[model samples]
Target: MSRTLQSGYHRPRMLRHVGRFSPVRIQSMHYQSGRHIRLLLQPGRSLYDALVRPLQAIGVTSASTTILGGHFDHLEYCVAPPDPSGKAVIAYSSPIDAGASFMVFGNATLGKDMEGRPLVHCHASVRVEDGSVKGGHIVPQASIIGATPISVLVTALEGFELRQAFDDETNIPLLKPFKES
Candidate 1:
């Protein structure tokens, strides 16, 4: 819902999540400098494999990546909406297919899940073949790269790592930076 102001501007209502508020609103960590990498996403591979395999080869497990414009043979993404189960604040909707789309840009976070395996959380804007523009969380494993190599700029985090742990306030597993054990 939105309210029109006297000044002729409209403001949308802010939706509150059904969860206990946490004292720590933003969970973040920082280092002196971040290691950078110019990565190329290879064609004919899942975005997950294209990112994880190469970065792991160089021992980079935790980082943030920016995916510059690129093409995909197939792409699927999901939007987040209020959770009906009350288990978490929000939940990802079912994957929406965007066939043969061109990725306008994307920001991805590389981390380790509870199982200690590589996990990539990526959000992107895409242009579908039919000329519709949409943006949402990208499904890396389902999205296949196109013929040309896609460029990605990676900022590797050092001294600390991002790990998914159960967040009590939100009652969800979220990635937070923690000092290396």
Candidate 2:
């Protein structure tokens, strides 16, 4: 009868996920050393090709990149909202175009997709054609680099690689740090 009713009220414990519980959390890896690269995104090429091809040539299979501000002939991005069907935690919305845009800054994690192909997961803030600023996940393959080249700082994860693994906690295939294959 001495319980303090004012400060700590009795509340039911709740579980977050719609699916069953997962035992594992925070799967991570470490590398002896990391490689760094200064990449110039080629002009007149898609953001995807500009970033991917050059890195591929140098045997850089996995990396985390920081893209500095630059111009884009055209750009597109998508936002992630709650999943309506309860199948996944969230889903990407339809592409929103920003014609003739200027990229402000970006964080991109590169890894292999489920099909074992290179994938770039990029998110950025940009100044659109209308002079408005916005931020979201970029559709790199569709985004065309402008006349001037863009610079990117690449932190290549060596000894281990990054690949998309199904995350039960989030119910999504997200890029995760993994051992080199």
Candidate 3:
């Protein structure tokens, strides 16, 4: 069943996860300071490479980045819906192409995957080629930057690193802060 507002706006249905809910909904850590970097997303590169390569070159593997409004030659995204297989609360839908789109805005968290590779978790609102605006979890690896450069404001996390770890509460992997080893 879908949720609809009185105004006729449709909202996604909430799913019941197959795990115990943690009492601590907000898991966070404090940092002394973060180094801010103004980055330019290079044209003709996948969003993942454009955001990861430059930051990695400067020794910034963990950060919170704000991607300014920009255009993309190609873009894809996924929405989270109830997991039909019941593995978890929700699973990402297959990539939905938003051909030659405009990214209205986005926020991305930089971290390490389970294999210690750079992982970018991004969510954004975009205007698809059809002129309909949609929002979802961005498929960075599939999205290609446009001909012009896109700007990003990055806050590099220091003294600690973000790493993906198994979360028993959600029965899925999630990014968590860990002391730099």
Candidate 4:
């Protein structure tokens, strides 16, 4: 209680938002069976295609994945900063190109978009050619893998599905777990 009050006082600022308050913070669920897949993201292919196509062929439409360290011929990522128009908390900057970079690791959530197609939301840390390390949201489709193959551990969610629906709280289309309909 004392620590919380001190921290609040130190900040002396309350972040303002443009939306109404909501009761729920974290919406989560569990499954009795977790389907696992050892996916190999082939070299010389877009990260999106490498992950999506093979999984699709196996009839896996939704999952959570961890991308192991690998290389990419051309990588594009974005940094999140304060929103310019104050519409929301933050917005992604223009895609930043990291030429011939090496991906250290990554976490991605696969879901269906509003159009009912595949969508991958991924954030990764990378080691750039200049020896600098950075992490951010990855543009998977635009990122082409290098000659070395990358491995990914995928946990497919059975019974239910993941969908990117318009989240009124965030005022964004975020991936949310849902019951299969």
lDDT winner between 1 and 3, please give it. 3
The local lDDT score (0 to 100) that residue 97 gets in candidate 3 is 88
- Quote model 3's TM-score: 0.90
Q: Which candidate tops lDDT?
A: 3
| Candidate 2 residue spans exceeding 4 A from truth | 1-15
Which pairs of residues collide in model 2?
A: none
Q: Model 4, 1-181: lDDT tens per residue?
A: 1443433335455665657666888888778999999999998899999999999999999999999999999999999998898888778999998888999999999989999999999999999777799899999899998998899999999888999997776666889889996
**lDDT for model 1, on a 0 to 1 scale?**
0.93
Q: Write the per-residue lDDT of candidate 3 for residues 74-144, one digit (tens) a residue.
A: 99999999788888878899999899999999999999999999999999999999999999999999999
- Per-residue CA lDDT of model 1 for 100-142, tens digit only, reads 9999999999999999999999999999878899999999999
Q: Is candidate 2 or candidate 3 better by TM-score?
A: 3
Instruction: Return the candidate ranking by lDDT, descending.
Output: 3, 1, 2, 4
Task: Write down the TM-score for model 2.
Answer: 0.88
Query: Looking at model 4, which ten-residue stretch has the lowest summed lDDT?
Result: 1-10
Where model 4 places Cα greater than 4 Å from the true spot, the runs are: 1-14
Scored by CA lDDT, what does every candidate get?
Answer: 0.93, 0.90, 0.94, 0.90
